[model samples]
Target: MATRTRRAPPKARTTSGPAFEVDAARLPPLGMPPAEFLRDYWQKRPLLVRNAFPGFVSPIQPEDLAGLACEEAALSRLVAHDAAHDRWMLRHGPFPEEMFPEMPDHDWTLLVQDVDKWDADVAALLAHFGFLPRWRIDDVMVSFAAPGGSVGAHVDQYDVFLLQAQGQRRWQIDASEAMGRTAPPLDFRDDVELRLLQRFNPTHDWVLGPGDMLYLPPGVPHHGVAVDACLTFSVGMRAPSAAELLGDFVDTLAADADDALRYRDPGLAPPKSPGEIDADAMERVVEALNLLRMNDPERLGDWFGRFITVYRSGGQVMPGEDARSRIEVEWDLQQGARLHRHPFSRMAWRKAKRGARLYVNGAGHALPARDAARIADNAVLDGPLYASLSEAGRDRVFELMREGHYHLDLRQDDE
Candidate 1:
């Protein structure tokens, strides 16, 4: 099979707004000293700026965004209301334009979630915001709202930055603590709208034209209604809960284990009435799971990194012919070849054992080592963070990166 070549990093396009510049010089240095705007105001409160991206045009056009919504494979939703009846409805799509003729023009929205799944251009736009660790990076979700379209008062569990690419939107934000009381029902309808008890205007509210941006911290209750046809890109952070981690980690363990780890029924005898799962059995199962989680920290990190990197997108990367041939080659750690985690990926923990070798995406290799510094550095960095490696190391790293099993150092691209 033909292998996909790595595309050259695209040139950084200039935008007009000074606030939107993400270069290192433009950003506040570590410690986020008291004077920095982002350190002082971000997520703690709402920030609105006019001309944030001065010359910024919508990365993806509204029509194109809509076109994506019409694909059966796309994740899209339509929110609409009948002003005459004061009734609201949400529809999932594959939508056709004709569905909106009867609804008032400005009272609805068509949202295309996870734009990164469909548009590589949008994904690149997301990459620019990777100031945070890539492992915490979440997918980009885009919404095209018509006039007066709103998504009711809601609070997200993770941080989000709302970037206005075109038109204007009126946003209302409130303390996230008020969410449980103010939030509309999961199935809330227009007739029984959950009312917000507290409200705050954008301490910096303004008509956001193309390039404007708003950053909101998780748990902040906010609502947005378009004042005109608008396109909004929501760059959200991923905040996985303990339950989600347990589910995925457990699934990974089950896949790796050849022996069935089924709950053993002690076959206990007679009580007056039969009951659901016994307490003793439950304790045994929990103990077994705890044992699994308590693997050597370094080994755990290697396994978790490989598991996360390979399945980050819910897609699998199978070995190719070249990969099969190169499987047994010895890798040089001193030369600096390393398997780096995806920016947004997360690890439950790390556990290392003797002779523990990591098979990335089930194709690439990360040889085990005894050096704590090297292991930590290699696992934590998004791409390679070390300096130049020996030619053999570079070749090995290149082959893995080429196979989409790892990411090499950014500087190495020039070499």
Candidate 2:
């Protein structure tokens, strides 16, 4: 569905603290360095961090989030818990403002996704998690719940960090890892939009306050319920399914293959049983399939860069001016202004045998090896650095700007 946006961007309810520092070296709350955190906890186990963002004030408020839910372009949902029936139900959003006041004060929750794309402060929270690679990130989802509301006991296929922003929420995660996507033993209620577990057993449980956070790896069953009216933010990471990766390879990897070659049986053997496909025919088919295999590093790297960097969100936007002529690009480059990549655009790259493949929003570009490293490492390129680019490299910068992926980093006093 398209986002029903207005003439001006919606201001966040509140902004983050002016001087709340985010250090890339020591990730606070976890009390662990990036290297240690990656080695011990990441993808291996869950980590509970108390006061992850001390004195943290959410940029958007519960009410503002509710307003965004009513926008057709923004993706939102309402989940209501029916404790009497021990079940949960969901309603798709594009909700009306009037529908909220009459809602039951308890047992309900409103969730809005991709908040980072719209709010700058929410986007800043992602920078703190820079310990992980950029391309793997999905989006930020913010939820506001009334007293006793819950999404039920369930496990997610992607990794997520649940950050408590307001009030309190008691969370519980299963100890035995009994719940899984492929294997099922848990009880589920029918006629519900959520795939919620009927019962949950926990080896770990905690009541998180403001700034507290819990990180769970993929396939960990967990449940959370509001102690009172509260808010939570989820930073989810993307992981492609096996089918998706294979589909990319099959559909994309050998698209440039020579179509002129046809299957031939030079060594024809007469078989007594005509029903069976002979070994020679099978060999030819297998050989052809092998030829299309993504075994080569450069070929695979090119495909992977494009595959992972594809943006999948309803609110992605091009920020800069469209139809920018070369003169305009040249003027912008020479103006000595800092350039920034838009938050909605996804970018990634891999070092090829000679140069590197630069991927942005699902498209790939080949550039010199030296420049490729600079592109991968540098998210913000200063004016002097932009001017220093060769003719081809400069043209690439212009293309990104024209596409609205790159532009002047002019942080407005207000969003």
Candidate 3:
């Protein structure tokens, strides 16, 4: 499927004036300082912050969500539960307009992934969570549900901040670590997409209004039913398992390695039984594998840089940023114009004293020591900040802009 660039322009029009500000302040929504929250709750337990975003209005309407679902490159699904028949149904989307209206009125949900990639205002909300490492952040998934509608009780492996963007939803969360262990694993019907636990004994339950947020850690079973027509924005994080990380890194390493770098058997010994592998052979294999330096400082940095900076498969896209030339962009930046990172672009880095491994998209590049360190410190360079940089620093700025991760639009009339 082709990637979907948002119908909405990168710039939003403001009423009466050009001034447009959507976020209140870059503060932890839960009233705790970022340090305190990260230390106490992140990946450790659940935290509910009521009206965390005070006077917050949803950036997009329910209709907007449905419209996006009809587009190619949109990963969407329709989930329905039939109470009368005691059956659950799941369907993938690119759904036709008529299909939604025909869905059961009171027990269905429409979920669309990476809304921030499509809407600037929705993407602005991510800046609020700047307290966390930006590389670990994933896309913002938006879901709309009918009254009494839910996706079922299932546990997510990664952490999620379920922000109620519109109307209200009743959330029932199972705090018990067992994920409601009722059986070895009961056979669920074919209709469900998740291994939904049948009996969910919730320790935390609440009806969340617009702007109300719930933070759930990994492995906690959670179920949410809409109290009325509503929209929920799930700010998800990446939490790859150790095995997954190693597997991908191994694949990456092998791609660049010489085919002749194979196992050496200089001291071969015959086994007593041909079917029985000797422990000496196994030891030799382990030693050869260890030589790959899976844990070496140099290789670890490379793996971390590429793994965290890969673009989401079907997320948002920024226009014209990649097509611009460095000198042309540097000239524009010299005029004191603003450049912002595209909402859909994922950028992260690993720093060293002399330089840094700055990864944008799936590729890693070396950055000047100061420029890289400053990004690690502040993560962005706005107009004034760009002016503050030396000529070398400003040139580095142009490189990021040309790469398409950071965007600049000269079409807008002087502010």
Candidate 4:
């Protein structure tokens, strides 16, 4: 059981922020390591880095991002003011040219969402942060904020790192406690769509130039205004609410319900009226949901894992054409085989059972009795780790990765 350590340059400490190097070693380890940062501040504070990505190329150019706004296929927005003085305005695309009529070059901006969806290069750029669990990884959102352009003050439920690739932007962050005390209901007006309740001034205010980055944990209120035109890449983390979990879980249950899954109301009496959903019926629904939660935890994890690993709509992975007949191939977990959950994926209430079994795409296969330990080790690893396995285990792992059930960084290429 040898851990596969990432060999890269160590992160260089800077007076202003975290060291910026292309290699993993140069950057702080992904996610908040418990020992490095205290628990309260780990996912609940703001951190600023003067230089986060050294030698980093702007993943999307400002002009290129603007061009994307013009295309119908792109998700863009325009936010501007229409008043004679002290006006506030905001707009989002796919936008047409008329939306920018005589627009002040400095006060307007075009924000494009999900750039990683279309650009593989940008997506690969993000994969470098896989030091964090793939399950918690969210999508990379890009905003080309122009001077006077702002999304208004707001709080995000998930953690985010704002990486400045070009120009300068002014940012203001407020603690969650302060924001909670005076938070206002979100308003969507025609003039100023997003409103802020608290005012913020950076204690360490300075223009963030290229390669700088800012990290904000969930619930921290923050707002950014472009001091000049700039490109900001947001690496957002995923955090689902209980309501969301229940909704998705219900959907999964409905899809998998057996033919004999009709609700039974054995204690029925002569109804006073035609029909009604009585307390008994409601109780039955609740009971069913409870049953799902109480089911074998291992099976639940397998179900959720499958859902989490599948690609998003229109995001496809092609298996090697020559490997169509390769059912007996081997999978080397030590070679970087790991599960990558989709950003929208939801976690299940179930945890893997105390046995050696591999599940992918809603299907499960039992591991051989002797190799159970190895299989279990791979399944529970929070980060990448390696273990040698028999041919059967390898084949199963390879097949799963090839199907895009998860990602496998093969150590040896089979020619």
Candidate 5:
């Protein structure tokens, strides 16, 4: 195993600079150095970072979020609380525009998932999360809540960073006990649509203003309520369960498995009881199943690369009716056109013996490791970098672009 090197703490900084730009060396959101945060807090404990984004202003407003909730493709929800009756109601969206005006002034919230895939400004916030693998990120979800609005107390099975974008919200968490093997079994209330905690006892409570942030590890039960109308951005991580991995892995194996392979027992002794399953029969069964086991490391790696790049949701990115030719792409690049990655498409890379395998939206391409890294890390293919690509790399990129993993932006050239 390679040893981790400890470095001096990083100096504090201001707002995350520009869209799709990252300075991995200086991460201000964590309040501590990325390495230290990863070591001491990542998936291990809950942390409250004050003024993580000092003077931060929301790029999108509540009206904008409501507008997005009206779109058919957007995954959204509205949660309303009836305080008088102590009742909670849940409704899924593409809500009509008129629904907002009809809603009660308080005790309601609108939440939109995968806002990063729909809005550039929301996606830009992802650049700040360079400390984690790109594939591990699910999406940036934005929530707009009215005064006294809440989703109820619940425990998430994945890590999350909650950043206050506007106004103020109160957060309470049960941090007296960390979640692990020794932690008590969790119980939920079956009365409501959401999986709310049966009982909640908060050990920490605080109200967050704009620019403040709260980080919670998986299985940490927490609750949040809007102190006033506010907008909050949730950066959530993806954690695939063992069953999900096994199911996908088996599918891949079956796709490439040999049909001719069969169980054989050439030399066998007669059984005293023909109906009974003897020890020898069980041994052969185990031996037969062993043929289906994954023995090659490269094959396993490739399957995992393809599996993770799809994340939880797939088929969001689709090819256009008109496909651009390689020549057209080349001409556009020469004309100062840039290539933008489809926000819904996930990318990741791994080193291979020959070079590296770049995985994008569940597709893999072999390229030089350096080139693979560049493609996986940069969402936009700029003029200089496009010029530097090898013929093979460029060809792969063109194919990917044609398949809708990326699109050409010609506004700059037109200007």
Candidate 6:
């Protein structure tokens, strides 16, 4: 059977005005000093902070989110539940615009991940979370649900901040440690498409209004049901499991290993039984595997730098179609042009013995620490910053720009 692509919803006009801002003096984004919150609640307990973004307004409307969901490259999902049968259904997108009108109004949700990468206004919210390491942030996932809509009770393996962007959602949580009790069994219902908890006993419950936020640490069973048509912005952290880390780490070692590096049985005593694997042989296996261990600090850091910058979706950052000379890029920047980081590019930097190395979309560039920091810290580069870069830094920037890690912002005038 031939597969047909669905038509995307019409693009909505971008929100006009100053980007979202947090007035720290009035009400902090975390409802208290960042350090205080980190010390008390971060990964240790759940917190319900009122007016985290006082007088908050959603950056994108439901329609705007629906439009993005229809884009072919979007990581989107539609979840619906049949309350009568206690059954749930899941469907991936790009969904057709016509599907929205056909959906029942109150029993389903539309979730789109990495909304920050898709919309600049949504990305601005990340600036307020400076208390945490920036690289730890996975992405901002936005979900729009009608009244009574929910994905069902579930637990996440990573930290998450559930910020109410519009309307209201009643959140129920079971933080076992904080409640001073044995944790609930981490079991899932086999019948549903979602990984919903088979059993949920929430000790804390609250209804979040616009600007309110809930911070949930890993392993907390929670559920959120929309009170009405609403949007929730989830700022999720990246917490790879031991298995995932080891897999990638070993893969890197295997790629760099020489063919000659192999297990040796110098003191070989033939096995008592040819079919039996002796303890001596097992010890040799352990010794052979130890060769792949990254003991040096620099080697460990280098491996992690490359690993973490890779997007969860494994999206590639392609260079611009037309590569420009360094001189051309410099001239354009001087003429009020701004260079924006590619949405798919994940970037990080590490200080080296000499200076630092910047990693973008799995590739590294050696440069001064200051220059590397500048690139990692600022997603958009402008004239003053460009001119301030050291000769080496400028050259690296030009190279990255040519490679499409950064591109000249065509929307600068509109901004």
Per-residue lDDT of candidate 5, residues 58-148 (tens digit): 9999999999999998999999888898789999989999989888879998999999988898899999888999889998899999999
Please give the lDDT score for candidate 6: 0.83
Tell me how far the alpha carbon of residue 218 in candidate 4 is from the true structure, in angstroms, after superposition.
2.1
The TM-scores of all predictions, comma-separated, are: 0.61, 0.84, 0.83, 0.64, 0.89, 0.90
| lDDT (Cα atoms) of all candidates against the true structure | 0.55, 0.74, 0.72, 0.56, 0.82, 0.83
State, as a TM-score between 0 and 1, how close model 1 is to the true structure. Answer: 0.61
Cα lDDT, model 4, residue 260? 69
Name the regions of candidate 6 deviating beyond 4 angstroms. 1-25, 410-415
- Candidate 1 local lDDT, 155-246, one digit each (tens): 68777877877777767654323222343233323353433323333222234555666666666666788878888988777677778777
At residue 373, what lDDT does model 5 achieve?
88
The best candidate in terms of TM-score? 6
TM-score of 4: 0.64
How many pairs collide in each candidate, listed in order?
A: 19, 3, 0, 14, 0, 1
Give the per-residue lDDT of model 2 (tens digit) for 129-208: 88888778899999999998888888898889998888888887753432222333467656677887766667556777
| Order of models, best lDDT first | 6, 5, 2, 3, 4, 1
Stretches > 4 Å off in candidate 4 = 1-34, 38-40, 67-74, 82-104, 176-206, 258-294, 310-351, 354-415
> How many clashing pairs in candidate 4?
14
Task: Give lDDT: candidate 6, residue 336.
Answer: 85
Worst 10 residues of 4 by lDDT: 341-350
Q: List the lowest-lDDT window of 10 residues for candidate 2.
A: 4-13
By the TM-score metric, which is better: model 1 or model 2?
Answer: 2
Model 1 residue runs over 4 Å out of place are 1-46, 49-51, 97-104, 176-206, 253-290, 310-364, 367-415
Winner on TM-score (4 vs 6): 6
> If candidate 2 were superposed on the true structure by all CA atoms, what would the RMSD be?
9.3
Error of 2 at 106 (Å): 0.7
Per the 3 Å backbone cut-off, how many clashing residue pairs does candidate 6 have? 1
Tens-place lDDT per residue, model 4, 304-414, is 555554423223444433343333222343343344433222222123444355544335566653343444333332123323556675565455546544443344434
